[model samples]
Target: MLQHLIDQDEGLRMVPTDRNELTTAVGQLNEELRGLPEEADPARTRVLTRWIGIGQMCLGNHDEARTVLRQSLDLAAALGNTRAVVATGLNLGDAHRYAGDVQGADALYRSALNTARSHHPELVDFALQHTGKNLMERGDLASAKAHLQEALRLRITKGDAGLVESTQAALARVELLIGRADASAADGAVPRQWSGEWTSWLQSRTTAQTPARWAEDFPALRDAVRGLNAHQRVYPRHLRDQPFPAELIAAMAAEAEKAVAADGYLHNGKWNAPVGDAASRFAGQVDLAAVVARSTGLEVEQPHTAVYIAYLEEGQFLDFHVDEFGFGEANLILCLQHERPTAAPSVSTTVFITADGCLECDLAAGDCVVFDGALTPHGRTPLTAGESITLISLGFRARDQASRTVTNLPPVPR
Candidate 1:
């Protein structure tokens, strides 16, 4: 009857139902366990404990889940139940993952993988799936993709529709991000010149923001980035040189003019700008999108919002503000034209407020800047009378944090 109940619970586990049913089930199982002799059936006890742990996890009681799952795993190991050990180990890993202990979860998953590979080939996919998910959350996209791809390949041969579909879906997500990261290199958009100073700066900045748990993996990641084709290598966050070829820039400028003429400028209490049809099209291009993603060191999705051409006229200025989330994490601004009356030392500078201090960037025609605009406070100095500037603004969202809404974030105070 207890085994029967366990089977029933497994079948109903994923069904959307009242939590009270699960709570009652847990209580009944515990009561039954207490009635059994200490040695009556260790196997049954292990199974019961494992199910209870799973139930606790479902209830969001991760601490309780971990304790019980650990006990179950020990019992399974003692009984030489390789299958049970692999299964329970995965559950324990899941408990850790849910509790935000990714490192702990990864260790358990790796152990499960080894055990399953040696004795339970059928269970290998489960181990791979969990490990892949854990690594992806930890920002190790390359490893995650490889694991998921392998799992998907195995699942397809198993001929289980549900399992195959689940793995496929996970693989698809990993591929999307991998494709984004690989786009720039594949498109031959890597900058012609890369400075050692810039590489050092990028390495420091990337390392500083990376989670401490990922410290050990940084060297591997750095080497992998370096190993990529010139077109495949990720670019530095801030580049004084243009990513696009001179010919491409000229063509893009022409398109910008046409787009502005068609869409006209719209004032949104921020600046006068026209819908950047040309910029949007170019941004959506695989090469440009890849460059944007690589430059930010983030796997990004195609821009959902339209790009814009900010047509700043004399006396026009932009207030310091961070771009909205989802649509503005990484901002790329291309200066199509900057005309100063009499060319009197141009004061049309772009300013970014950083922890270090204020960074004043003076952009000339054809120059561009790419930065984390979603979190960084930035703005433009007012244009002097008879001064004018044209800029194409493009934004991309980190794939992991993609959202359709353009959150109206408040401006940062100077």
Candidate 2:
């Protein structure tokens, strides 16, 4: 009778829509276990306890779930049941995560992953997925991406469409958090060939009194000196408009808000912001590269560079710099939210350096700008005090050069 109840509970867990039924079933199972003999099968007892904990978690009883899961884990370990141990450990980790104990959750996940890797290879993907999620919540996006990528490979080989989709969704979230894995070269370092030239230009600009003086002295460094009025040539076309659907814009805004509320931003010295989760998922649903191609008249390849949303706060400023060769050939920026003190006189602007002079673009919510970020130098002016802005940045490679490796080329300054 106990074994029959255990089997029924397991089947109920597989169909989560019957939550009330499952909860009632778990209660009956617990009552049956209490009436069982002390000499009941230890393995069955371990599985029963783990399932009950999982049911508790489903009902949002994290504290109760953790306590029961620990008991099940101890029993599994004592019985030398590796599979049960791993499964129970993962559930315990989820309980910790649900209770906001990220550190505790990560420790349990790592233990489960290590044990699965050593004993139960077939179950490794499950451990990997949980560990990846725990790391993502801790803001270790690169590490999270690595784990999810491995889990994805394993899931694909297992040929489970549902499992594959779950891992893919987790990976997409990580990608949104930390742009593309290859968006920039390793460590954002400048290439050897351009380092000396970049250093020289920096020194000259530092000492030069005015833009004209720098332009006159370094005529050979025309490409390096930004915002210099040295030429009267026409620059590349830069279009600004509202092109995204209203619903999509609203979804992206909601994602940004949720990310901020959850403290999901990665605090690198460059910028601390959470890229929009909806934006990444939307990319999968739509052919964004083709949209870029139609708008810019450039043949764009699929799988464009990372799609990310950047949140800029007061006193934050982006220095003028050209993008890397392929990834930034065509760049898109969409303004999601912008707020400033009404009394403040200065307006923050996205500035592009062109042959004519500085072209300043003031964007509001729903506004977007498309430009050649790879060849042109661009940046944002410092936000005035009490000001903030949220912008989603998308990158694409021109079809002609999409196949080229980014490492082989020089790095673009940030």
Predicted model with the maximum lDDT: 2
| Highest TM-score against the true fold, candidate | 2
What TM-score does candidate 2 get on C-alpha atoms?
A: 0.50
Please list all clashing residue pairs in model 2, or write none if there are none.
none
**How far out, in Å, is residue 400 in model 2?**
1.4
Q: Tell me the lDDT of candidate 2.
A: 0.66
Clashing pairs counted in every model: 2, 0
Tens-digit lDDT track for model 2 on 10-48? 211223346677678779869876877999998878877
lDDT of each: 0.63, 0.66
lDDT of 2 at 383: 80
Give lDDT tens digits, candidate 1, residues 345-367: 65667765444344567777777
User: Model 1 Cα RMSD, Å?
Assistant: 21.1
- Considering only N, C-alpha and C atoms within 3 Å, which residue pairs clash in candidate 1? 185-231, 185-232
lDDT of 1: 0.63
